[model samples]
Each structure stands twice: as C-alpha cells, then as structure tokens.
Target: MRRNMCRNMCRNMCRNMRRNMCRNMCRNMRRNSERGPTARNRQQRNLKIVDYFRQVFGEWAQVEVVELVNDGSGLAFGIVGGRSSGVVVKSVLPGGVADRDGRLRSGDMLLRIGAVSVVGMCARQAACVLRQCGACVRLLVARPAPSNAAPLQSLGASQAPIVPSRLLADPLDLERRLAEAGHDGFGALCEDTTPTSPPPTVIEESLHHRVRELLTAFKKKLWF
Candidate 1:
C-alpha cells in the first residue's frame, strides 16, 4: 500500500511538470509568430525609403550634414513638396548661409533638419520646424552628383524662398516653378539637359560662313 501511494505521487508530479513545460513552449511560439510580421514590415519599409532616396538622388545616397546660422526667420533655402512626395531643395539663396556653406545645393533631398526628421514632413511642416529652431539649424541632406550639362538660365533671380503659407496655399504654383526651373522632379534635375546639337563653337561658326560663301558662288555659276 505504501509503495503504491509513493508511485502514484511521483506519476502526478511528472504529469504536472510535463504540462507546464508544454504550456511555456506554446506561449513562446505564439509570441514569436505574433512579432514576426511586425519586424519584417518595419525592415521592408526602411528598405523602401532607402530605395526612394537612391532613385531620386542616384547612387550617391550617403547622408551629409549641412549647418546654417539663421539670424531670424529663414534658413535661406526653400523646401518644396511633402514627405510623401519628398521635400527637395527648390532654391538656395545667393549669399545666404546655405549658399555660403556651399554644401547645400538645389535639388538635394533633405532628410532631417536639426532634431526633427524632415523625411516625412511636407514643405510647410519643414518650414515650420526651421522657424522653430530659431537662429541655428543643422541639416541632413543627400546630394546628387553635379551634371556637366548646364542648367537652364533662370528667368530672373530665383523666386524668393516661398513662405510656408504660400506653399500650403499654392502647391500647383510651386510645381510650375519647379518645372520652369528645369527640375521635373527629384532625379530629373541631374539628368543631362545639354542640347544634342549645341550652338556652334567659334571654329564651327567660321566653317559654316565659308561653306555659305561657297554655296553662294555655286548658285551664281548655275545662274550664269
């Protein structure tokens, strides 16, 4: 009887331990399954952002810092569009802090301005952030390679950096301005716009003049 009782107690203890182990194993598996998709989605989203930057700025997707000291309201550079479409440098004012620094160029994509990540913010939001930063601001930018092709001459001094209110009110005008400046979008600015048949060089012009004279003589001979 004593032996039977001891045997029964051992069996019950073994069964309880097995049940606890199985329960813990199931809980771990459930947690892993639940967390898997979230981790994967985050990774994929990051990859997409990187790819977008690369597509817009070309292979030069490395991040760079641009520091500027603003005395008052502006950073002296204009940002256009939004985080979804991306905020691009629409213009860098001549003799402004950015221009003086020379690292920030028109068409560079802004990743961050100071502590704020400008990546997903619209132009107005970005401008607002810059305004809040007061006198000094640091920027993270991605610059594309300079094209050998000459940019279209500006109609005048590039339009003054648009105010945030103006950006919000007249987004279409902003698009038009960018188009007029020969920037279709982000990557379009760096694309070769050099005329396929460039204006004749000095030597070519002289040759053309001589050919014209020869042609005129041949015409005279035919007439005779």
Candidate 2:
C-alpha cells in the first residue's frame, strides 16, 4: 500500500511538471510569432498612416514631447481614432509605463511618435509609428486646452504657430536649477559661513533646527 501511494504521488508530480513545461513553451512560441513578420507587416501599415499625415500637415502641427521607457513589453495603451476623430487614446493598461507616468489619459490626441507625425492618422497607423520607436518612446500628445482659455486661432499666413501652455522643463534647465538650488544632503542643507568662530551653543542648536525645517519643506515640494 505504501509503495502504491508513493508511485501515485510521483506520477502526479511528473504530470504537473510536463504540463507546466508545455505551457511555458507555448507562451514563448506565441511571443516569438508576435515578434516576427506579422508584427513587421502591422508596423508597415501604421507607418503608411504617418506618412499620409506628414504630407498633409507638414511641420505646422503643434506638439510637445513626453518620454517613456519601454521594458521589452510594448508601451501599454490602447488607441482609437480615424480621419474624422484623429488618433485618440482609448485606454491605458494598469501598471504599464504609460499608466505609471500619469501624463497620458484616455481621449488625449496623439500628435506624433518619435520623428514621424500621426496627427490625422487612425489608431492602427499610430500604433505602427510606435513600433518603429526602439526602446525609449518619445510621444507627442495634445491634451484638451483649459475651458477658460481662449480658443486656438486658425492657421494663417500672418499668424505664428501656437505653442502649448505647459511644457516639460528642458534637461539642461533642470540641471541648472538644481545647481542654483544647491546640493541635497544634511551637510549641504544650509550653508555655514562663520567657520572661523564657534557659534554659541543655543545658536548652533537653532541652526540645526532650521536646517531640518528647510529640508522637510524641500521634500514636500518634490513629492507634490
């Protein structure tokens, strides 16, 4: 009876192992197929839409850059659009890079992907433009303007192109601001000038307290 039970247990374990291996293999195969020619054909079709937009809009389309990192898995967002509606974000997958970034939202109009324009393209075309973007994707999306803001002026020979009201800070500008703000860390929290003379005990304690207060305020600014 003991021998029979042991054999049964071994058989069950072997069956589970085989099932797991098969499941993994199938998943890998599916991924490879997606990464193959079917994927390339899909991409090509999307690029055609991008080209059509470039021909129509030319360089006059207003756009802003939002950078996102793709972790092997595709940028997780669904798009829906056409010539009438233009390419619009339909949904953002939870826990995906787009969701985590918090910049993209459903109904945001896609302007361009990387160097190519998708302004007037459909969803499939817009997605194709995304596939060409290697690892780091630079998306140009336009959110709805504020309700109180003036309506966008029609394009004309006399008018300069309209720029978005809010723009992401340039990397160089951010670095310069950080330098102006001074270094982070407890030691650099506050500057000390009178190193030649020792500060009074009470004064020293007050200075330390002031440093903690300033640090807390700075952190709050960063968090919010």
lDDT scores for all predictions?
0.56, 0.54
Clash pairs, candidate 2, are none
TM-score of 2: 0.39
How far is 184's C-alpha from truth in model 1 (Å)? 34
Candidate 1 per-residue C-alpha lDDT over 98-165 given as tens digits, one digit per residue, 9 for 90 to 100: 88878788887765665555655689878876787778786656555345422333333322221122
- Give lDDT tens digits, candidate 2, residues 1-224: 99999988976876676556556655664555445557676567556644554443442333334678999776899998785457878999999988998878877667656555554457886786688778998665655444443333343321212233222112223222333434221011122221222235744465556556655664566456
- Check candidate 1 and list the clashing pairs: none
lDDT of 2 at 178: 32
RMSD of 1: 31.3
Runs in model 2 deviating more than 4 A are 1-63, 148-224
Badly placed stretches (over 4 Å) of model 1 are: 1-41, 146-224
Worst 10 residues of 1 by lDDT: 160-169
Q: How far does residue 222 in candidate 2 sit from its true spot (Å)?
A: 78
